[model samples]
Target: MKMKSRFDRNFDIINYTLLGILLFIVMYPLYFVIIASISDPNMVNAGKTLLWPRGITFEGYAKILEYKEIMVGYKNSIIYTFVGTIINLVVLIPASFALSRKELVGRKLFSALCLIAMYFSGGVVPLYLLIKNLGMFDTIWALVLPGAFSIYNMIICRSFFVGNVSEDLYESVKIDGGGYMRFFFSIVLPLSKAIIAVMCLYHALGHWNGYLSVLYYMRDPDKYNLQLILKNLTESISTKTLASEGMSTDYLADMQKLNEMVKFSTILIAALPMIILYPFVQKYFVTGVMIGSVKG
Candidate 1:
């Protein structure tokens, strides 16, 4: 390679320096949280645990795991994420494939309608009543079925189907006497792995972290997802610990430590799944999102 000019060299140095600084700014808080979860809360509260863990401990995790409801929440979150993603894929693929076809009747009109729904929606009250009328309220269906289709995700799938898939493939299927159903299942579905993986990751992550739905429709604590359970625990910790009737002098310091730890630990616990899941889907995610952006 030819040697770069001084200007180019300086620009590269400046760009890298800026990017490195930005990366540190973004990553430090996450790093701090990870360390804080395992560190003694007294050190964290006193600002002594900033650069590295001052005192290591797992009291926070231990306390969090003591709740049986947390386990139930984990079970519910997993069920919701897996089942919900399956429904998302099953519903999205057919709709997207149909929409991707240029020869399909009312294609433009339907696409226009989908775009409109993205920009507009009825109020929360109307949505609640609709779910209630549909007999999905307080059930698992309420969590998964209401948000089964996302307009933005559907559009991405449609974009992939239209732009990435070759028209000649569909023509070949038709020439071979394959109908729409056979063509989609055999050709489009199999070839659309990247987009499907992208959709699955997005939908599954959203479902796993979902708490608002549980707060709104779910009256039963048994149905609470992990996020909701952790949220409640984090919120309740301060009040419940401070207001306990029989707290003596000796326990006060320990309760204070536990309370501080609970704050960081709750966030770490809730976010842990997504952090773990991202690396596995990252390659597919990149390809899927890139192709999904191709406009037809």
Candidate 2:
């Protein structure tokens, strides 16, 4: 019994040690980014800052916030992310439910069409021209409309419904005279929390990080997303263009350093909301992915 106890103790130690190492591997990069963002850019370039910050300053954040463009960009990003996620959920939930039903007419053909779109896309120029023709250019709809339906997300959601939702329960509901909308609202949707949360996160993050779509569609600087504005800020800092625009040398130098810091800090800031929200939804994401991957 003593030998067996010792063996179990040793096994526990090994398991914990392995977990600790894995944790360090995952966390160190995030730590490094945080440190790098606060450390002096020269120190970062010199590889002197890793786990701890040196020459710490709030200048980066201050500069990023001081710019009117950055503020506007943040507001626009918030608006886009909120509105985009709502539209995504509204469309995706019904679409996924419809596709999950085997008895639905044209299911196979519709699924095939969606799958085909996953691989082939209309080229960028054509898509741009289409948006332009529709008079959606320079509008928030241009950013949100283009990505209303993600085929991959739809497939995952449909697969999750098939694997996780019991057809028996659905049939029982149907026999009780519960219609499609009623079953969806009362039964299927309630059980589909995991997949829905996962889809929301996926769609939200995509909209939040995406800048190319905004750059292509939006001509007005006021409509620029945070990422696009960040890109512009970086360019201005690097090229010393702010100085060329009649800024004082002292201000330019300070702005340049702050810009460098914010380049990394802004990424951390931009990513913070998702990072904080992910843990609550992470369990659902795991379950959803596992169920979605298994064939019914």
Write down the lDDT that model 2 would get: 0.84
lDDT by residue for model 1 (88-201), tens: 888888998899899999999998998888898897899899988998877899998878888888888887887767988879989999999888899888897778878888
Clashing pairs in 1: none
Candidate 2 least-lDDT 10 residues: 236-245
- Predicted candidate 1: what Cα RMSD to the true structure? 2.1
TM-score for every candidate vs. truth? 0.91, 0.83
Predicted candidate 2 versus true structure: per-residue lDDT over 251-279, tens digit per residue: 77666666678788777766787788878
In model 2, what are the clashing residue pairs, if there are any? none
Candidate 1: count the clashes. 0
Look at candidate 2 and tell me the lDDT of residue 295: 48
